[model samples]
Target: MNTISYRWMTSLVFVLFAGLLGAWSAADASELPALNITQVSENVFSAIGATAAPSRDNFGHNNNLSFVITEGGVVVVNGGDNVLLAAALHRAIEERTDKPVRYVINENGQGHAFLGNSYWSDLGVTIIAQREAIEEIKAHGEASLSQMRARMGPVVTDARVVVPDVAVDDHYVLELASEPIELRRFGAAHSPGDLSVWLPKQRILIAGDIAFHERLLGIFPDSDVDAWIDSFDVMASLNPVVVIPGHGHPTDIETLRYFTQGYLQFLRDEIEVILDDDGGLSDAYEIDQSAYESLDTFDELARKNAGRLFRQMEEKLFQ
Candidate 1:
């Protein structure tokens, strides 16, 4: 088999094995919530998180937590949403290899991305994030902790706001591993300081919140849809053979394009039509998002996303 097909089949086999093991795997003996781990490549693995909103059941694990085992050590992506989840992920890593976790890279400053830094920080793991992400964490980390506490209660009692040890501007090449991992921030995306972890040698991209496959991408108050499209285009230019997204299972670039950029463009196009016709925000909300109705979180975010984009477009038009 070709190299690409071999890697894909290997990953598929691991996924099927994980599925057969069920949601709560052997890691449950550690008394922590077990993540569904999927092998992406030879040394790369990802713990797929729940697609639903953060809650007591999922322990605020609403985003993917991934890791790469390298000759130097293991590098983790997304500290997880809280201490327990991070600890749980660590336990799973231990089960795989004996390499110590050398670094934890936060994809962004969002709670699900960096809140678990408390766990890694306590262990003296070097943490890394984009400069803007560090600033976002410094400014809003406490608020994110409070929100997780409210949603998860005692589960997040040990969770605290912890910033990264290293902050890079737009690009940072992490070389501790045999296969150097490149962390790059294209621009404004799903959230501030969003970045993707690119394994050039493997042609696999761990796209943080920049790409969403199974779920509907959220448009936050600060999100710039226009810039997001531009950023997605830049990231897509890499032609990744495999894509591990922030909130879904390991997928391909085409799937991300269909669900993320395609969805955003569809909403923006619909909103532009409404604005040109002198329609109101309510009309924007009623735009046909049925095509995306099958996606996770569509019920919770579809109309809200449309309304937010409408306001954003309207503000830009008047500006």
Candidate 2:
């Protein structure tokens, strides 16, 4: 582990210890999810999302938002689901640092990732993402925003769709606020253009939707189970000390191994067994998933994940 400077460490400690007391106070006065900042490292802080579904009570802020303070300024990981939620996150970061937000990364192609772009755009902060993410937003951003507005109502007010300012086809590395940030795309996992933000020096990983902790990893129409599994291997290779997943609290790699990677592997193994037995999607869904039953959104996503994995595995068999 890299040794952190004493002064910097003290600042981090202050942020970690003192930040919590003032964390929830910075969010908007409206009914948005209360944002709390936790100092994960000397330079890293995160506003964890609700592990449960977005309701009028939580205001669709059920996604993680993180910021890394660099010597130059701050680099935000993922923007929140809507404008107001993003505004609340902005307030939290503002409370901690006087430096500007130098960069904002919409980690994946999901609508929630990019919908908050307008808020940052007005401040002249450069938004970055994978080319595939830009494409995904262009194709589905409006519809997704409309659906989210209808579902969350006032929480997403003033939320407008904005494409990233900078889009890259592969890895993009640069020095932001005097700190190095490597943005990598590990093929399709959660979506066609999922991205992971790696701080090489800190060994901190902001692992978008590619890894979910307690919450059930989603399997959307654009998701690929096989690729998602491969991406887990890629994440493990980084050996991140702290991982900020898309929808859960920050966790260690070991917890992630068992909860995220292990659970996915178990599902694939079970689905393969069902396929080997000449079973179908229904049978795959019938497999004992009691282990993950207590996880948030298991009821909403587990069977669907099973069905998706089964279809993918079956398709691969023929190919």
Candidate 3:
């Protein structure tokens, strides 16, 4: 063949090979469940989760997973509920940027927030959480793994408890790229070690479980209602322009306040009235929560929240 013909053949072969490689990469990245990603700011993105309780259908993903892209690398918030879910989130991140995930931040010690650390750990990514959260994981990580396995079946079979590599007491900062990511633990909130990721330059806050907008926040046995209120006040003082809550879409401060702090205060007030009348736990459950009835998981959490708050208040009053 002439030199021109030979060169033309080589160029055609290279183009075909490149096309095939691209197709395979795209398919591999899409193998997991598609995350509902919303770009909240120029470099920050949020994968909003279901507002309902964790279930097999949702693959135990009932909490938000977010990430911020920086010049250095990507920082992921919430390791995710299980290995599969974490892998899914990583795939979504891959689709958006080529930067490696340098850090995985657990907003709290909840299973959905940190159980997927196993996946990140395998990748050798550094995991960070508040000191209390690290302690919570050390105490309850195995139990959380069991719970996930029970609820999600084989979907979570590969998940293992991997404690964070870095534990910050109150505040830690990641000066990656042009944006500075600040992790702050105000105080007790929805659960142990609940923290928020603040981007001062962007005026955006990844409020984690510290702020809930569309859903009624679950008051677990460990949840400190009064302290949660105080923590909310401190977090609100940040005056974030956008908040990516733990269980809802990205929203404003007012919406987060109305649903999280407002709901907690409303419940506290009602429980106080019950206590004033010498009411019992049953009476606490009967208190009106009509205003927050529209929130997702209201049926599952409202009465439980009221009863828990009543018990907490009772103990405080008698102590």
Candidate 4:
């Protein structure tokens, strides 16, 4: 670990927290400041959505994040870049219970999922995540944080990126907080491997990137759109009543299919547009964004699902 300047850290925290207690905006709705957390159901908790992504924070919707306060301890799903959000979550957990958080879970390998891991790991909390997430962080965490320092700021880089203490090869079902928890690994969709934290006791599903509320899901360098669409079916299989998305607000099982259909269809349309335009791959990407900006933010995820969607479109066109 590299040593950081304390003065820089203090200044950075202040700059990053300027809006911590302010009003909300749709864009700012993506942050997980402690104030956002709300006890939605019995023993089920989440940091409500906030507007804007933080200066150093990379992912847009670490928002709508949550933790499960089991009788034994609290289990945090996504750590939100690092300790600031993680500590905020820890504060929220304290409000609901005196139980120590025994487990930290990641729904996906995104920075939002694993970056804040140091907080729990330091406290001897067992970190749980998919095999792929562990590998990705090990491969890229440091470099990513270094590059993101300016935008997301110094605290993110100051915090150590952690790997999963427990790696699941396939789906794993276990008990936590005296409740039956289903850690379902539904193949590759949003990333190499995605885990859906299911609380059978509460009938709540933490549907990471598998579903989003009124926003375009990001299909990154590792994402598979078709497989991502299929993952939605997997999310639906549980027939969850209340869902905690990786971003935005809570949603239901019904919206998963609705959003998936729109996402998949939009990809198909872009593929057709790319072929008809007879343009190069890059051109198709640009064209798709201009044409589809009106679709939905989910369609505009990373502002470049357009390119990924276009690449998939081009592949299908050639095939």
lDDT of 2 by residue, 264-302 (tens): 789999988888899887898787888888889989988
lDDT of 3 by residue, 35-68 (tens): 8899998789998898998887786788999999
lDDT of 4 by residue, 1-319 (tens): 1113433443354445434423222123245453566676888887865434444333323456688777655677776665566656666676677666667887767676777677666656788888888888788878755654445453344556788889986678767547877788766777876877888777898877777655556677777877777667766887788888766677787776666546666765766766797866666455444433443453436347666777766776679
Better of 2 and 4 by lDDT: 2
lDDT of 1 at 113: 92
After superposition, the stretches of candidate 4 with alpha carbons farther than 4 Å from their true spots are: 1-33, 56-61, 152-157, 276-303, 316-319
Using TM-score as the measure, what is the rank order of every candidate, best first? 1, 3, 2, 4
State in Å the error of residue 163, model 2: 0.8
Give per-residue CA lDDT, model 1, range 200-272, as digits (tens).
9999999999999898889999787999999999999999999999999999988999999999999999999
In model 3, pairs of residues that clash are: none
Clashing pairs in 2: 72-177
TM-score of each: 0.90, 0.87, 0.89, 0.79
> Which window of 10 residues has the lowest lDDT sum in candidate 4?
21-30
* Clashes (N, CA, C under 3 Å) per candidate: 0, 1, 0, 21
- Against the reference, the lDDT scores of all candidates come to 0.86, 0.78, 0.84, 0.66
Error of 2 at 269 (Å): 1.6
